[model samples]
Target: MFNKTPFKGTSRTSSGYSYDDDQFASKVFGEIARKDWQDYRNTFMPVHEIFKTAVMSDDLTKQQLDRIPGNIDAQFKQSQAQASAINERMGLSNLNTGRTDISKGLAQVFAENSARTHGKERKMSAIAGANISPQDARVNQ
Candidate 1:
């Protein structure tokens, strides 16, 4: 947003705008007209750029541009629906921290069961390695 401001007590230079001439300063109306001309000149480049783009765009390009707005609208709606489903499944992002407690409980149960199984296997291996028949062990006892 370019704005036109006059050279006051403290002067600011606008590009291509020269310092106020004593002669020009004496003529307030001329200075106003000069500023107006500069403002109009500044507007030219942007307008020309837009005009060039409009001229170069074909019907296909125009259709693509038109589709962008609609596509954005549809994608936003789909994403919102997806977010709702995810929130419901996860018990709401803000309210639920995680299932850490359940995971830890299951891990403890697994460890206990694994230890019992290892102990049973070790005892069975020792008994088998001894090569003692049940009757021989009973006679020894």
Candidate 2:
């Protein structure tokens, strides 16, 4: 008689007969998918931190400009110059533009990771299908 075993690791299915190849494949794929996601997140962290720094610097500059005692025209000119310098250093027109660029980059990373995970899963499924009984494969489909 077949006995169901609880899965201890990340898996597409929660429980299956202990000997099932599909169950093993799902568990292994899940682990690989999780690791890939973590790596992507880690890679994006520096970009996210740089964005945070830019926002903080912009806020600090605005606050300092507010406290300066000068003619409105002079102060406005100084603020514009400082803002332009910051934008240049940040390689963006403004914080919003930087955010848009980062968001697009993150989207691209996500798509690439997803494609990689799907490819691995398809390979595992194919291999498992070849080894499993025909009846089991038909039922899985």
C-alpha lDDT of all candidate models, in order: 0.51, 0.51
Per-model TM-score, in order, reads: 0.25, 0.28
Cα deviation of 80 in candidate 1 (Å)? 1.3
Q: Pick the candidate with the highest TM-score.
A: 2
Error of 2 at 67 (Å): 10
Please give, for residues 20-130, the per-residue lDDT of candidate 1 as tens digits. Answer: 544444466666888898988798878755543443334323344445545555655575678778888988853333564565456555555554554455445444664
Q: What lDDT score goes with residue 65 in model 2?
A: 39
Deviation of model 1 at 54, angstroms: 15
Q: After superposition, which runs of candidate 1 have C-alpha atoms over 4 Å from their true positions? A: 1-57, 93-141
Q: Give every collision pair in model 2.
A: none
Report the Cα lDDT for residue 12, model 2.
39
Minimal lDDT window, size 10, model 1? 132-141
